[model samples]
Target chain A: MTDRQDRKAFFRELGKYSALGLEMALSVVIGMGIGYYLDRWLGTGPWLTIVWIGLGFAAGVRSLYRAAVRSGKDLERDEERRRKPGGP
Target chain B: MRKAILVLLAVAALPATALAAGGHGFSWFMMLPGGERLFYMYAAVFIAVFLLVAAAVVVGGKKTEEMVIPDPRFTLRNLFELILGFLQQLAEDIIGHHYKKYLPLLGTCFLFILFMNLIGLIPGFLPPTQKMNVTLGLALVIFLSTHYFGLRENGIAYLKHFLGPVWWMAPIMLPIEIISHLARPMSLSLRLFGNITGDHAVVAGFMALIPVVVPSVFMGLGVFVSFMQAFIFTVLSMIYISGAVTHAEEH
Candidate 1:
């Protein structure tokens, strides 16, 4: 039972970090697609596509930044644990 | 754009299921988005869901007493309490004190998904979540519900949440928000589909090659994957709901 819980915790950690990369890629693709569709519907050539790409790119960056900062905090916490006197 | 992503994701996610069906579902058939009618995967999913709901209803919420020998079927109340207790702890841990309001949604998502994920582990049955439509449908529900709750909580100002912080960033933030939102369903669908398909395929392959020996090991992994995927999905949904409903000041 304890082993199963341990494994679940391990996989839970794995899923969260792995999802970060996926979020980065899909966000841009989604943005570009939305932009392209809007441009096609409006008969406005590449303008909307260009605008949508920028938004997508920004959103992707924002998400990545948050993940990076979060993981960094996690690292900082680990470091604190290590540096604490009498820490195992 | 979504149609293209949906096809690409569906195809990419379930090549293993195709191999299991001896070359169907996951191949060029998926290119025809609504072509799910050709497979019984959807029906299997509904059956699984129906069974789960019916059982939970029948079981009701009986309180558990200590049992000398704990069997899942024999100790129904114990099973219910264990699952409900775990889910409550998970909800409070992830979504905080306000978790009570969101408990029903999260609990249903977890239980239904856990059921769907487990069905494939039963031989001769294909899980609904193995299909693009099933996972996509779930992703859409989470997406819509989170936004619905968010809007209900924040009113018209909810629209401004997409505008982002600086007034000048509105034009940039809007499309980005839309793209990010679009990506959620894509990511959710693809993740569940790929994980379940991969697990089921490994078990099938082992069962074919060496009977139940190697397959049992992988089946153990399948059980882990089944529970973990459901947990991840529920947690992500909770995070989304909480984020949407949070005050602008917190943002």
Candidate 2:
């Protein structure tokens, strides 16, 4: 690609990645907000809020973890398939 | 050569500069505008930007069918497909076959962070990720999402994952696990906030000094740091998610 085209592509990729990051961040914020509100409603003080909020955060992390594992395994499988004779 | 000359000229205009502009020095949060503090602003900006982008996405989705002009730039559909494919591959590799459900969340997280980090490179913009509140918010989501998925996947049994291998250790192990789980968000937020903030500060500091060939190198480093931070954040999130989804099996 021409230099200008490459630059444009780079910016586009950057924008795309930024969007992804924002989504993840927002999810955490939303989860925390919900946990806090639930705690207030249930009259559990800080304890329940902390616990449920922690749970929400954990759920987010778990999803992220799962994505990583899936990506890694898929790469391995693809590599293995590529190595196999007449695998195409 | 022209770019180098311009950089030098800019540097020359600045007053006396600190010796180590890029060092991880302490940032005074209270000193910011109106004593409003860094974290508070960070939260506000993150929420505002997120809402704006979300609205844009919704509007864009609604207009997907119509094309005003045949522009050579990549179309929204093509971009979405690319992102979907990337996220799908990531999910499938990590969660086995159930990757479809989590794709939207993971994909969105990765793309948003990547752009936020890149925004710092612009001349006048400060990256939202550089602030602790933003990172904290992001980390908090990952922290919560892990358990949410856990409960959804295994119900009450999800809590059992934190109880340790044997019943004897449940009392001690539960608290320990809880503390460690709490630390995840703290670590995630600190790591991102520290790296981006430090890198940006350094770039600014360097440009303030020697006004020569030096700052460009730091700018390159800034780019590298930005990309690495995004990758690490995504990887950690994935690890946490998979752990929650498959918690019951190992225990």
Model 1 docking category: acceptable
List model 2 lDDT by residue over B25-62, tens digit each: 32332256653446335534564586467557645655
- The DockQ-derived docking category for candidate 2 is incorrect
Per-model TM-score, in order, reads 0.73, 0.60
Evaluate all candidate structures by whole-model CA lDDT and list the values in order: 0.72, 0.64
Q: Which residue runs of candidate 1 sit more than 4 Å off their true CA positions? A: A1-15, A42-51, A67-88, B1-74, B249-251
Error of 1 at B219 (Å): 1.6
Candidate 2 chain B: worst-modelled 10 consecutive residues by lDDT: B19-28
The candidate that wins on DockQ is 1
